[model samples]
Target: MFDSATRRELYEFTRGTEKFYYTSGDAEVELNDVVYEQITISRSEIKNSSDLEKDPLEITFARDSKFAQDCLRSALEENVYVKVIKFQHGQQSILWQGRVVSVKPSGASIVLKSETNFTKLGRAGARLKFQRTCCHDLYGNGCRLNKADWGVQTTIKSVTANAIELRDLSFDDNYFRLGMLQSAFGVSVGIESSAGNTVNIIRRLDSLADQITSDADLLAYQTAVLELDQTIATRDALDENDPNYEQDFADAQALVDQKQEAFNIASESVFFVVAYPGCMKSLTACDRFNNTDNHLGFAYMPEDNPSTTRNA
Candidate 1:
């Protein structure tokens, strides 16, 4: 029921948010999370656009219709703007699409890996424990040991972030690079910068979102962090010498690593990720659950309905 200008504003905000979120393919977004989606009204009212994403708190400070109008007016007057990203559960998973206003850097996208990847990791069974990734063998020798024998990270690096600029992380002059990991439990990361506009914007929105729901904001914040990463890779195999590195990034590595560790932790965590969200939380995790994909070593989880809110 929003008008053209208002709709555009909402669209831009929603698109920007989604663009930021989708770049992080591995980021986890639960259902009914109250995410905003974008919708356009007409062709003529394309006048209102923004060169940049507005601080979400601005909505709170001016949480009235008049303020919203003034804010929209100022936003439209700017140089150019970007469209917002919103997910509508279409036939498939959440789908996102939008346009950019002025030219700006596009961050990485967020995607959910197929259930097969989960199955592969689950196959490692007791072996996922070594605190490493499969790429330990990438270096040819890896100290003459079977590269496969050493520990490797779970996720693989995909795209690079523009905002991230590496500083220095050394070890008694031997020096190790500052590293980030992307996985499941620690999957939600956030953006950061010693200097830049994006990180600042990220901090502000996350801070405000936290006031309302720490968990929700944290998820949104992490989604940004995971997207900044060019791609996921085990820390061991991640190429530090590769010239292009993101200074600001979250360790989704930890999340994947945690899953690798879950092989040993409570079987429930395994069922939750490996099986299904609904099935794991239920007494059925042991049997009734049934995802043909998750059937190995683990039982399948049942399909959840909209009313189901067993776990956050």
Candidate 2:
């Protein structure tokens, strides 16, 4: 508000719930009670071409700044969204808006390369294919499964480099394979496999250890389900006289009954993780999900070549 001709810029960078605000002025600026720290930040020209090609925006930050340090520590990367606002003549207007696509760190500064949403619009969508596996995304419209019904809120018993041990869970082993585990701190990680209550993660979350505590809770979502019916069937078919049968099939039936009962009685407040039966486009999988009518795959499609016949 000092001079009508005075100009300054505000930079807002966000990824998930993490945010960084900076202002390109000698003094700090406060908007909506949130302070934007004064920092050495600048941006490249915003270009719009007649051919509908939006030029990428490059924002440079001082190499020793918090933003640059976050980038180097792998906290902020290509997933970040950046918005630049220009304040001139006592008015504020959006200068540029885009997502960070790449980062380049030099000796003195770090430059974030971002592309506008128009670049995403120009990309092609995935084509549907006639495959044996269901093409529908988990919890997606085609899958017709509610994610909320398949998730459980549980406390973290312990944490390791590549895994997290959850508190006592009633679900069976491998129930959360290919699923998602979100920590209370909003850090979501892909589950590689789960045994009992221990969940192995696909990648290490750097900030998870610092953000979680003994009482930290996590939301586990069952994205892919293993075929438990097959296991039960195999256990049932085992010979009574087999030496290992008793040990191998111990509590198998009881475990199934326990899981089914839990599923039937599960509620939002229940700490137990409800198990989904299976994943795939097979009729058995569809039956397990109890959504056979919504199955998106062509399960009846002929697998053999019509033009050639082979003897078995």
Candidate 3:
């Protein structure tokens, strides 16, 4: 027994030492802060350690530098829309630091456990929502949570159930409830509306186009290209004496290039299909079925159909 401790103290202490209290709680301590939890201080030995050395016996300093980088890295990879600068989690070196496991069945507080093998959090589990900024940063982005239980301090990114129409996805620094946040820094953390996206697409398309020279000029240019192609296909002619032949060739090539550019513009957004087989087969079918003239362009059914397609 310790010289300072009495026999009665030792007997009383020995019995209390065997008590096993299991709990889940968070050790609300800041990073780099020094803290400790006594594991198994003996009956009388609890008092004799003060005089042993200058460093003293019992406390351990919790530092973030060792594992902070790792913790942040893990959270960012597993959680989406996570801002690393605002994220924090329990320091493993800290005696009582914990992680919220889930919400209790009652949907009030959360179930938590210490990150260490031999420790537990405060008196009992917390609401988890109490640590919104931390929990949201650590778990919420793509967390598979059930809304029927547990309330997180942070606003969730998304939820299931057709009945629960998502109101919005705006969040703040804490990524907590958007309706109640201190400030939303940088861009609004809101999902773009269907209308907004459509407008953006239209603006992009308009930006890509420029004014035409004139309808008359366009038609004349078209006529020149048609004549050049038709004449070129007719014969292998040496038109060195014809002053317009070179100009016609250039114009026709220019038209082809321009048309190709036009086709490229619609490449991703639209598609067309020329059905009913080859021209000969198509003409035959037209006669056999008594079908009228028709134009098929930019029709869609999710993917390309088995036919030649052209732009409208």
Candidate 4:
């Protein structure tokens, strides 16, 4: 029920050593108290947005209990869900959901591993396609999406010259609007700002060197890009000869591409465009789909419908 790619990604996520309790209905199993070798469990999450995997559980236990063996085997066949609860000082703190991936006997121990529901859904729903209009397609076409699914919720505390302070900050709540955006530019959740014919574009300013409006501004933008490039350069110097060098290089290029795109977007307005906030952009790298970062580009807003720009 799990794919090799999903397994590899999850295996990497749960490398560190930790101890937790395994729970399923009325059954609660105690884990190793002092790094016991026979009984072990590891958990982690897969690192993708659309294909985001869930935290999986890997268990290695002694084959002394027939009940344990029977339960694991039954769960694997029935595809039952299990909860991994983390406790601190005798108080439960974190909870994770997973399904049995494998249950096999190895010598004196029963080796069992369960994958997170996230990965399970990804694998099971891989062929299941849900057709819908994206923000990129329906940005100005009056096709609105439920903001609670995409936007975050946070409270505005105070606005400062350099930064905006927020209270009760929460992300991924869709209903929450950036307080600083609302305070400074009258931007709120579900509200679209009209460019109102005042919006104009500055073409061909694709890179730091190309966006040189003034010597001072040019120096500033160039310096910022140079600093970012230097960090990437340092990483490349350290890991260029590694096995994953090509993948690392691609990731770095994607980052540089994102930065350049941001610079180009900012060049549209003297201050900042109401419709073109960098925060609105999707920052994650989608390597499985062609290493593409889905976000606002030069042709994001249509020339005909310039007024409507806010999208989630």
Q: How close to the true structure is residue 2 of candidate 4, measured as C-alpha lDDT? A: 24
- Winner on lDDT between 1 and 2 is 2
Give the true-structure RMSD of model 1: 26.6
- Choose the strongest candidate by TM-score: 2
What's the ranking of the predictions by TM-score, best on top?
2, 4, 1, 3
Cα lDDT tens digits for candidate 3, 1-312: 112221111000011122112111122222234222222211111222233222111211121121222222233223111000111233232122222122111121111111221223223544343210123321223232222232212211222221111222232222222211110111111111222101111011121122112334444545655655555554335365787887866766676666555445433232111101111112222232232133111222132564644221
Task: Please give the ranking of all candidate structures by lDDT, highest first, separated by commas.
Answer: 2, 4, 1, 3
- For model 1, state the Cα shift of residue 173 in Å: 10
Provide the lowest-lDDT 10-residue window in model 4: 7-16
Q: Best candidate per lDDT, number?
A: 2
For candidate 1, the per-residue lDDT at 120 reads: 30
Query: Could you tell me how far off, in angstroms, the CA of residue 219 lies in candidate 4 after the best superposition?
Result: 99
Off by over 4 Å in 4: 1-55, 72-75, 125-312
Against the true structure, what is each candidate's TM-score? 0.16, 0.47, 0.14, 0.24
Candidate 3 segments whose C-alpha is farther than 4 A from its true place: 1-201, 204-213, 237-312
- Per-residue CA lDDT of model 2 for 1-312, tens digit only, reads 356587878999887688888998988887778788998998898888755355889889876575664554343323688899987876889988888877777656778888887787887754678765566655656678886777776656666998877776677676677667766544455677888878887777555565443431222112111234555676688788888777767767676665555444332222332322235456556676677777766655654776553221
Q: Each candidate's lDDT (Cα)?
A: 0.25, 0.66, 0.25, 0.38
Candidate 3 matches the true fold with a TM-score of 0.14
Of models 1 and 4, which has the larger lDDT? 4
Residue-level lDDT tens digits of model 4 in 1-312: 222222111111121142223332222233344221222333334233453343446555555444345443233323344554444343443355555577766665666667666675556442312222122321221223222333333332332332333333332332222111222233211122212221112211112222114434445555656756775675567576789898877877777677667566544422221222212323231111122344323323433577754332
